[model samples]
Target: MGGATTEPADEKPAVYYANCAEAKRAGAAPLHRGEPGYRKALDRDGDGVACET
Candidate 1:
């Protein structure tokens, strides 16, 4: 019984932003947890939302 989805091991790598500014510039600001380019460092309040203004 499979309950989880399977992803290709060679799938495109996850996105990463050095900082919120970078993310904003890339139009990926306000990233949320579980989304690509989302990091704890980006989430100042640890509210699961990153790069939020």
Candidate 2:
């Protein structure tokens, strides 16, 4: 049987930016609703858009 695969130590964790500007500065802007690192906090209005500056 095959065992579960482990994540690489060098792999970085998902980053949740405080605002769209922050996410854009990190080159992770234009985030959609389901994209990684996208959080509801980023979408203050909760209109299915995140990190939209």
Candidate topping TM-score? 1
True-structure Cα RMSD, model 2 = 5.1
Number of the top lDDT candidate: 1
**Candidate 1 regions off by >4 Å?**
1-10
Residue pairs with clashing backbones, model 2 = none
lDDT for position 16 in model 2: 77
Q: At residue 40, what lDDT does model 2 achieve?
A: 82
Query: What is residue 4's positional error in candidate 1, in angstroms?
Result: 31
lDDT of 2 by residue, 1-53 (tens): 68988889999887678778888998888787888878888887888778676
Q: Compute the lDDT of residue 2 as modeled in candidate 1.
A: 80
How does candidate 2 score on lDDT? 0.82
